[model samples]
Target: MKKLFLITITLLTTLTINAQKVYSTDQSYKADVKVYVVDQEYQADLLVFKVNADYKAKGNEGKWFFTDAEYKAVKKIYFTDAAYKADLKVFFVDSEYKSGWKDKSKQHFMY
Candidate 1:
């Protein structure tokens, strides 16, 4: 039981560390998060809450500070031309609880 508990904790920690911190990048490096532009808020896979400050940001919310340099970004994201090209299909929800991946298999992209 203890071994399983430890493994769970370690896995959670690793996932948190590797979670994407999205930054809109203009350059050539492959984006960690490939975003799609949905016409309706309901069409999005992740309902992104844009927080004013990075410190205030929690969970999926944060200040997406656009960086000229690709390396500076924690997670580089590009807007896909079509929804099919996107790794994850997102819908912007009004409430925090509403935000999540439409396809559960692609949940790993956000975290």
Candidate 2:
């Protein structure tokens, strides 16, 4: 029973660490990552899907759950007006299945 409980705890911890819980900051200086929304899908480095629940925001596979408070977020990001000013360029997709990194080179920015 104790071993089972420990395994469950470890699994939950791993899930929580990989969860894409993000907070949007108003100030660019306060953000961990600067993001820009691209007009076209092909112009984006990442295809993002906004998940309805926090638990659904698993992995750095472009699944994101926006947190209300900064303290609850794994990453804090600021939206940039220009793609040149941004650290990452993203395009929001309608479906979760469509979410993924187009440029695998920029994948480490989320981690």
**Which numbered prediction scores highest in lDDT against the true structure?**
2
**C-alpha RMSD between model 1 and the true structure:** 5.2
Model 1 error, position 43 (Å): 2.4
In the range 1-111, model 2's lDDT, one tens digit per residue, is 999999999999888877899999999999989999999999999999999999899988999999999999989999999989999999999999999999999987888
lDDT of 1 by residue, 2-110 (tens): 9999999998766545544457755425777777767776666556544444433334432233445666446678777788777755554455455544555665676
* Collision count for each candidate, in order: 6, 0
lDDT of 2 at 81: 98
- Candidate 2's TM-score reads 0.89
Q: Each model's TM-score? A: 0.59, 0.89
Model 2, position 92, has a per-residue lDDT of: 100
- Model 2 residue runs over 4 Å out of place are 1-10
Total clashes for model 2? 0
Per-candidate local distance difference test: 0.58, 0.95
